[model samples]
Target: MKSITQLENKKVLVLGLAKSGEAAARLLAKLGAIVTVNDGKAFEENPSAQSLLEEGVKVVCGGHPLELLDENFELMVKNPGIRYDNPMVARALEKEIPVWTEVELAYLVSEAPIIGITGSNGKTTTTTMIADVLNHGGKSGVLSGNIGFPASEVAQSVTNQDTLVMELSSFQLMGIESFHPHIAVITNLMPTHIDYHGSFEEYVAAKWNIQNEMTSDDFIILNFNQDLAKELATQTNAQVVPFSTVEKVDGAYLENGGLYFKGELLMHADELGVPGSHNVENALATIAVAKLSGVSNQAIKETLSSFGGVKHRLQFVDTIDDVKFYNDSKSTNILATQKALSGFDNSKVILIAGGLDRGNEFDELIPDITGLKKMVILGESAPRVKRAADKAGVTYLDAKDVADATRIAFEQASAGDVVLLSPANASWDMYKNFEVRGDEFITTVERLKG
Candidate 1:
């Protein structure tokens, strides 16, 4: 990590105390900043804030007292999940105090160049692919950001010889200033997080922030298939390397049934270990990064050929009586579920869906439901999902939980059918996160085997 003296003696406010917030607070304190951490959780209940207090950082807990902003703080490193309209955040903005997410801190401290990956979907898979292929080619690639590990924590440990492969989210990007990555990848654009971002335009604007400080020397890998991505290419100073599954591009693309990078054939399109055209797009993006990093085509080929895909994302569980089960619990939005459904023969899919009702209808999913055999709906969005299913003329059932959904899907599945758990909404209404939701599905599937 680079030794940066910019924060020395600066009064910084860290709002919220998730892994990112805690890491940012600690890192700021280490840099001689007078750090103050505020969390909505009560002091006794917030272990991270308590620990920071023990280390001499000021702690304000129980609630976000608006008066905290009167402290004349120079910067506020907020938890990405915290809304910008949050009183403290809004007040800070009004007062002209810079607000940032921990990702900015990651950029400030890391000696290594970062490869930031962000999009509506496929960020995790693309980040994982680039990291894996880089590592396989003798390049040091550390995974961080929204993929689970805090970018602040990972950045501090990586040296100039390593590459930080970060999975950035629009929320985190919305808070960046000088957090520029040497290589940036936007997997694709879609309308999502409308609740948090307020609109698709705002969300897209936030994602665009990933390239705020990029220059001509940098590279931004874009999706040629997306009009928004193509438009973005013309706006960034970074050299645009396009990836597409539809037609040939100057960079990575598929042509004549083979994946090619800059006119050189890498592998057959069907040779990728993971299924789906979405995975193919992800692979094209990965190939662009790999080739840019000087990774051998053989290493890229080997990694892509064996990469089984990320957990909770179209993950193959096990087959029971010739009926296959897939755990795609990470599909928290309609577009994701659509992509997941596109990977299988819909006529043979017994889909288990429904979760948090994010104030959006499932009408968009009707087109994708044309051939599904059955849909097992659950959680808060069941009624809405059932409405869409009804409109699509697909058979539907309701389940109380993942266990019930899994059992019902299995029962409905005939030999050669797929029991897919790809909830098209957030799991906050029923589970802590998608991983937990996927885990429950896997556990129930295992029980079915027993």
Candidate 2:
């Protein structure tokens, strides 16, 4: 790790002690910062708070007392999930304190060059692929950020020879100050996290901030298909490398049924192990990162040809009696479900969808939902999803939960049909998370296999 002294002797507040916050608090304390840890959970129940207190860090728990802000902190490291409208955060901003997520801390200390990836969808898959490609080409790529790993923790161990492949969210990006990536990627933007960002424009602006500190020596890869991405290309100080699934671009693109980078055919689209045009877009972006990272074309092709889809992300479960079942529980938005539905023959799909009501209409799913063989809906958003199916003239059934939905979809499927669980809303309404929802679906499918 680089020995940085910017945070030394700084009085910092670590807000909302999730994994990211705890890591940041410890790191800050070690950096000679007078770190004060604050969390909403009670002191008795919070292990992170207990442990930090043992380490000589100040712990304030049970609630976010507004008076804690009176400590005159120089910086505040916030958890990405905490909204900016939060009283503590709002107060800090009002006081002119620099608010940041652990991402900024990771960037400050890491000896490794970072490659940040963010988008409404495909971030996990694209981030994973870039790491795999880089590793296969004899480079060390440490996967971190929102792909179920904390960059702050990972950065502590990364060497100068390593590359930090980070999967960033707009929430994380919103807190960043000087956290610039060597190669930044905006996979594609869709309307998401509107509740957290307050608007789509703000959400896009937050994602665009990944390149805010980038210089001309840095690279910013963009999706040419997105008009906003194209517009952003004209604004960034970094060199722009555009990728497209539809037409050829000067950067990575699809042409003549093959994936190419700067006109050199890297691999054919058919050779990719993962299904869906969405993955195709993901691969194109991965190609840009691989080529820029000095990875050989062979490594890129090998990784793409063998990479099965990410777990709970359009993952193929089981083919029971010739009926294929796909678990896509990670799809928590209309755009995600749209991409999932587009990967299959809509007429042969028994689509299981619905979850938390994010107050967004399912109108976007109309085109993909039009001809599904059967639609099984559940959770708080069931009625909303059903209304979309109804408008599409498709038959629908109501299920009690994910397992029940899985069974209903299977019962409605015919030989050669696909039973896909691509809920178009967040899993919070039904399950703890998408992974739990996906596991239940997979376990139920396994029972059917018996």
Candidate 3:
């Protein structure tokens, strides 16, 4: 069982009964912590909650209660989906109660050093790549966080010597106070979760918080080209390593179809396991993290040559005749979509963009997507996204859902054009989550092919 000595036999409240929430509850219960779950959604509506309640987890469904959460529990293991400013959690804080994200909880239980990845996009790519590099280098590290297993899941089985590789989201970082990883990376920053964060500064502050909590012995790797990253690097007390795709720095970067670390060629950049210049940058970031962790350059090179990229983050499905169909369901922010659009050399692209709008500024992406042959938009921000496209001088179409938008996307795309499902918003309006949204896009594309 995962070590929960700090929380063992203690009263803990697991908020939001989602995957991570339930996982925390189950582990805590096994460790003798009294676990009670609370979620705002109906038990029947959320399939995950049904199974969780069946496991002897006392659950409060549909709404929160003032009594169950009133400082009775010593610690609150919060699901990342729930906001930091959530009323119930706020109430607990009034009494000096502590709140911990599932990720932070995982960090405490882990006796091993950790590698953390955070960014507007490509965090999963970098996280997976870095973990893969470690594992391939004959070291053991688990891929967890916004990518694979939740950190709670990783904590259940890790040993003191094993490495913990995590992808940290802005939400998960929101509640973190002192949780530190030996190696931390912010792949890049772009305006994301503007709705959840109130302002762009607040959003950036949350992203910067990962580095903010680092101590002197900790190592931070960042994209030097991003102004926010550069500014943060100067201010960080930890050892700051700067990585780039366009230029070489004190760390990794790309050269003529090859990757370089501080001017030394490490691997062929053109042969990076993932597609896009973004992945090249991700590879650079991952390599830099691994090297800092003491992984040899030879192992890093070997891993990059053989590792396949993560699915849904620029995953190319199939080409029907001449058009390429790419699923960037992982592109949950405008900046990520901008990188995706820039990665391709095509002059014309049928961009399927829109989802639950997250307060991202569409202005930054307005100019470059002129090659957007036509955009078949979906979800809550369709009209807003259409207007952005209109202002950018691109043709536009509207659809009500992912499937409908993809259907329209197929019809609008031509032999030489690229069809991209890079929604610059969250995936809650028409789907359960981003994975569901991405899966539905691929399924619809396969149906269109037939």
lDDT of 3 by residue, 129-239 (tens): 888888878889887776536687677788877888888888888867767888899988887677779888898888887876678898999898787788888888889
Cα error of candidate 1 at position 6, Å: 0.9
State which candidate, 1 or 2, has the greater lDDT.
1
| Candidate 2 residue 269 C-alpha distance from true site, Å | 1.1
Q: Please, what are the lDDT tens digits per residue for candidate 1 over residues 306-380?
A: 886467977767667757788999999999999888655565689999999888899999978855889999999
Model 3 pairs in collision: 9-32, 258-269
Q: Order the candidates by TM-score, highest first — what do you get?
A: 1, 2, 3
- Model 1 stretches with alpha carbons more than 4 Å out: 309-450
Total backbone collisions, model 3: 2
Model 1 score (lDDT): 0.89
Please list the residue runs of candidate 3 whose C-alpha ends up more than 4 Å from where it truly belongs after superposition: 1-4, 44-55, 309-450
Clashes of each: 0, 0, 2
The per-model lDDT (C-alpha) reads 0.89, 0.88, 0.77
**124-226, model 2: which lDDT tens digit per residue?**
7798889989999999999888764678888999999999999998999999888989999899999977878999999999999999999999999999989
RMSD of each: 13.3, 13.5, 13.5
Q: lDDT ranking from best to worst?
A: 1, 2, 3
TM-score of 1: 0.72
> TM-score for each prediction?
0.72, 0.72, 0.68
Greater lDDT among 2 and 3 belongs to 2
Please give the RMSD of candidate 3 to the true structure.
13.5
Better-scoring candidate (TM-score), 1 or 3? 1
